[model samples]
Target chain A: MKILVCISKTPDTTAKISFTDNDTKFNESGVQFIINPYDEWYALVRAIELKEKDPSTIIHLVHVGPAENDAIIRKALALGGDEAFRINSHPGDDYYVAGQIVNLAKEQHYDLIFTGKETIDYNGSSVGGMIAEFLELPYISLATKFELNGNTATITREIEGGEEVDEAALPIVVSCQKGMAEQRIPNMRGIMSARTKPLKAIEPVAIDPLTSISSFELPAPKQGVKMIPADNPEELVRLLHEEAKVF
Target chain B: MSVLVFLDQAEGHVKKSSFEAASFAAKIAEQTGTEANGIVLGEVKDDLQSLGKYGIKKIYHAADAQLNQFDDEIYTALIADTVKSSGSNVVVLSNNFNGKAIAPRLSVRLKSGLISGAVGLPDTSNGFKVKKSVFSGKAFANVEIKTDIKIITLNANAFKVTEGSGTATIENITTQIPRRKVNVREVNVVKGEVPLAEAELVVSGGRGLKGPENWGIVTDLAKALGAATACSRPVSDSGWRPHHEHVGQTGLTIAPNMYFAIGISGAIQHLAGVNRSKTIVVINKDPEAPFFKAADYGIVGDAFEVVPKITEAVKKLKGQK
Candidate 1:
């Protein structure tokens, strides 16, 4: 069985976010980037687990970004992947990114495709469903737990206030979230061997972005704190009613 | 250009977020000089006409029993078909679980421009530009969609629901529930006083409370204020709280009216999840916790002493009211 895991690099969780070029582009000066946790922790780790269980399962990692993302791809390869492919282009929208991936995955026809639920940077959880839609396969989003037996994949998806268990045949697409797998760190041997793993940069396909960003603005500045004495807990409730009117 | 809203349901009742979607659709329809309509799949128990209060002029409900269970593919096809028949050029849905699953597929099926988690109404002067939360609610962006058929999934509580005197007539639509591909086995529901995402009032805890045994300090306050309970990542990772309760970049990002943090030293990631809140209150022993910088109110005290006093004060205030 062949598995294709889509990965992306996002600003580190602790990285301070500031925009550039009048907020039309994200500022990258001195910003640290890492494999999106959802991709590295949930999607890729689960694929590695499947490969560990069945040695015949071949896992491949795919990324759609410029050359800077190659470092992130090598890190993903360090986790557990036969090869990594980077589509060297910056997509202005999620659909275009999905279009590039769909083009690549279509030729491979892998039995299973995996992606993080959403990138922490954009928080637009659309790529998985868009890929499945273009591919015309069953797409499950925000999968918390996934299991495979024979050709059937049973998935537990996180819904509004609960979770629902579902099953679909192979050649399916899944977007993973927190409970799908645990986080793994690359060790010395894994990092050293990752350098020798195959990392290919492919030419990009032409797809127009459906949407364009005009500008970005920071949320309104917060009102500084109003300190209250610990002994005056009652004053907090009174202020909640009179001053804030929140309660 | 007609506007259509997908009123998502759970346990045969339309969700509150769907109403917010309705108001949003109404805003677009009013702007475009069109009528706002709605569609509901499965067995919905609410009076369909009452949705008119939210400004929908008509409702197309497909009451097929099989449609009750969420199959995004089937629902996508159905919504696409309804859009074709109704001659609607715009679609609106709450950017919650169901909308997140369907919007992307529907966009591809209809070949339309899609916006997920829109926080502002579209500015249609030159082209259709909508403001959306980005970078996990830390920043906002104005995005332009150039497609004729546009799909928008609204963030929870982004638009306020306003009731008009109009009552929308129900139009029953016939849709074929195709052979199911994703078989649903069982559902595990967590019953809370308020759904965490939509809660206007929230009380969140961090690992400083120690363990699950000491969660009473957090819950006791939340129960008194009738607020939802949330946790920082470490607390959820330690298994002291459920993963859904984790309110950070990786968990659920929420924007409540009042956010009370206990024992949490706000990390940048954790702040990204909740910085959109209207007001924030932080209570902790350490005076230098980062959350205090973001909070509207701060009380430097131990959680054990501070939370109980606040809970009692809230209960006393409610009783007096």
Candidate 2:
């Protein structure tokens, strides 16, 4: 089985998000970039699990970014991926990113493609589905548990209210969420082997971006906390009804 | 110039978010001097004509059994083909799982500008600016769509469902159904009084509930109020509740009208998921819990005592109403 895992290099969760150059681009000054936690913890881990279960399975990591993202690609290799490919271009928008991924996946004819539900920075959650459509394949999002038998793969996802079970074929895309697997740190031996793994960089096919980010800004700070007497439940109700009008 | 709305349904029923999407599209149609039409992929048990109450002039049904289950590839292609046939300049969908999957796909196929998680109508007076949440509900961003075909996926429960009376015409459309490579073998449904995502009111508990044995109080209150049940990530990880019911940044994001959090400390991740709730009520024995800072109503009392009393009050009030 050929498994393709899409990874994105994003600022660490604690990094302060800011913009530079008249608010047109993300400012990366003094910010540390890491493989998106969701991709590393869930999607990549699960793909490695499948590879472990079957040695014949191959796990390849793909990213849409510039050469600066190679270190993160090497980290993913250190974690578990057998090989890595970096598309030599910054993803201008969600459409361009999805198009690049779809083009690559189609060229490779991967049996299964895995991605996190959404990237931490963009939080778009649209690339996996877009690729699925471009390839004319089934897609399951936010899958917590997945099982494969022959050509069919059964996935369990949490819907708005309850749990729903769905099945798809081998040539499908799945966006993984939590509970798929526990996060793993690379061991010494694994890190040593990752240094020898092949990390290839390839140029992205030309594609026009349909969208652009005009600006970026931080959210307003929350209002100061208001404390109420602990013993007075009626006061709380009154505040809700009269002041907040939310009841 | 008609507005086409994708009405997502599951198991022969329309989803709650679909109604919100329909109403949103109808408002847009009214603004643009066009009529609103809905497209359904599979068989639905509800009366298609009754959807006219939301200002839909007609409903298009592609009644293929294969579409009864969600197949993104087929759904995207069908929607793209429908837009072309109907000549719809504007497309609307609910920013739920189905919409999230198909919207971007449609955008790429149609070469249209797409905005997901829209909270309000676009500012048509200006080019085409749609307001959407950014940074995990921390802020808002106004995005402009430059393309002729504009697609907006409204957030679930963001728009109100308007009630009115009208008889919509139901038309059966014929289209070639794309072959799906995926196959569904079995479905495992979780049985409970309320579904977490669709519930207007939710009652959630955390590790402060002590143990799984004491969970009856939370469940009883949820039953009395006809609300969905949820747990903080800690509770779910501790095996007190299924992971599906976990609500947080790393978990499920929900926007119910009323959210009752009991014995839970509001972590930033948890707050990210539920901050969009219209009203938040927190009940905890600790007076200094962070949840109280964000709660519209806070009861600093023991859940063991406060939950039962609240349940009794809800039962009594519901009987009266």
Best by TM-score: 1
Q: For residues B1-321, could you state the per-residue lDDT of candidate 2 as single tens digits?
A: 899999999888888889999999999999989999999999889998999999999998998887898777788889999899999999999888778878988998898878888878988896887877655654456677888999989986789998679778998988889787656555566666676765788899998999989999999888877788999989998889988788876677777888889899997778767878887888888888988888777777888977776776666645733
Tell me the whole-model lDDT of each prediction, alpha carbons only.
Answer: 0.91, 0.82
* lDDT per residue as tens, model 2, A1-247: 9999999987765565567787656778988898987799999999999888988999989999988888899888888988888889988777888888887887789999999988776667888877877787778887888888887788987565555678776788999988888889999888898889988888898988765555555555546444455545445545544675533
Which candidate wins on DockQ? 1
Q: Which stretches of candidate 1 lie over 4 Å from their true place?
A: none
* Local accuracy of candidate 1 as per-residue lDDT tens digits, A1-247: 9999999899988887889997888898998999999999999999999999999999989999999788899999888898989998986698899999998998888999999999988888999999999998999899989999989999999887678899899989999999999999988888998999999899889988888889888988876899999999889889987899998
User: How does each model score on TM-score?
Assistant: 0.98, 0.92
Clashing pairs in 2: A160-B197, A161-B196
For candidate 1, list the clashing residue pairs, or say none: none
Q: How many collisions between residues are there in candidate 2?
A: 2
lDDT leader: 1
Q: What is the DockQ (computed on Cα atoms) for candidate 1?
A: 0.82
* Model 1 superposed RMSD (Cα): 1.3
